[model samples]
Target: MRYIVLFLHLILFSIGNAQQLAGHVYDKNTQKPIEGANVYLDGTTLGTMTNKDGYFAITAKNKMPNALVFSFIGYETITVEDPFSYDKNFKVLMKEDLIGLEEVVIGSPLFSRKKMLAAFKGQFLGTSKSASSCKILNENDIVLHYDPDNHVLSASAENPLRIVNNYLDYDIIFDLSDFGVKYNFNTLEPL
Candidate 1:
């Protein structure tokens, strides 16, 4: 009888100790809830998005040591090292990443814009078999620039790139924070 009582207590204790991170993401300047913000454990596929109310909950269980990443397009990504430190309904304030549109244009007369984009996509998305089936839904949103003198190419996007990976059966909303490819000095080829 005593062993049965101890087993019930252990079960309840374990249930209570389950690690669940719950919080609301908001714009720091506006103090408004940030809907659709990606909340996930860094270096892990476990993730969830903030609801319309900016509320999100992710169960990490034994994975509390991993940093929790809060990401949304146009906002600075936030990483919390100790998510367990915060109580439920924790407020995560994210600041906007100020990127001027005029600055995206680093034009080089040597390489055509179309060619630069193709190069960017090649390096950004590898030439693997799975990549063959991947498609960028919003190619227009991508901004590319090349510097022939330096043999360097850079790319950025104002919005997240919607990618359809038919081979993987996953729709990826990739926020291209920054991308660049530099050519090998001797080969003059993208390295």
Candidate 2:
């Protein structure tokens, strides 16, 4: 009988220790709930987005109060500590604002315009540079060309370099638009 009582007490204690926190996110100025905002319990996979009404919920895994990070495109990211304090109904207010300055863009839609432009132009940092261009062929191979001094870069892939998975990166530090185009610039060994 005593063991049964102890078991029940342990179960209740664990349940109380692992309290759940849930809430909605909103724009502090708009006075409207934020929808589709990412709400994560700090370093855990326990995350979800606010509903159309800016509502979200998650069970805390530890006794320590978890911080909730609310993020969305355009609006500034907001963080909440001790989310469980407010009766599990957390409210987050974020200020809407622009992110980019000058000619720099922080983020964009997948397969976005910036990505399209950079796909052929490439990314640059200091003295590092890379770029590429390709021509559709009638066969099964891509021919690539790089003429640094002559200013000519090109490639022709017959099969389109098909594979299960592929990874690509670039580093562009100089511009040789006068030379032509590159099919793909990969390595830049400093000479």
Candidate 3:
């Protein structure tokens, strides 16, 4: 009887540990439910979209230290660190991202568009076997800028950058918020 009781307790503990992390996302200003919001554990493929009512639930297998990221188009991304420590169902408020819509005007670039594009591709997509098979579907949507003084190459796109990874057999829609690569000024090599 003692052994059976102990076994049952262990099973119950395991079941409790498998409980999911759930939450609702809403707009800070409008207080309306945000549908189609991206909820994911940062750096992991475990992701899900919010329902029409702004409810989202993702399996929390273990006590993860990763940040829980909430993102959507035209909204400021929110990151909650140590999500496992919070209540099972919490509320997330997302603010509007107004700056993303502002137009950026650039003067004459030091390098040609073609050259800048090549550099951007090489740095963004690495020089690996699998990277060769990957292609950016919406290259035209990206805007590349090189700051000579800072020795940095930056890329921005209003729409999500579409990527087709033939090697991995995956179509990725990446919402690029920020991207910049620093290089050695003298040798023109990535730092």
Candidate that scores best on TM-score? 1
Which residue runs does candidate 3 get wrong by more than 4 Å? 1-13, 100-191
Worst 10 residues of 2 by lDDT: 123-132
Candidate closer to the true structure by lDDT (higher is better), 1 or 2:
1
Mind giving the per-residue lDDT tens digits that candidate 3 earns over 1-191? 99999999998898788858898999999989999999999988888999999999999667778899999998999999988888979799999998634456568767777887877778888878888888999999988877888887888887999999989899989997788888777223555
For every candidate in turn, the CA RMSD to the true structure comes to 8.9, 12.5, 9.7
Q: Taking the candidates one at a time, how many backbone clashes does each contain? A: 0, 19, 0
Q: What are the lDDT figures for the candidates, one per model?
A: 0.83, 0.57, 0.86
Tens digit of per-residue lDDT, candidate 1, span 91-133: 8999999976465444446767677777787898987999878
In model 1, what lDDT does residue 40 have? 93
TM-scores for every predicted model:
0.50, 0.47, 0.48
Question: How far does residue 7 in candidate 2 sit from its true spot (Å)?
Answer: 4.5
lDDT of 2 at 145: 41
Candidate 1 TM-score, C-alpha based: 0.50
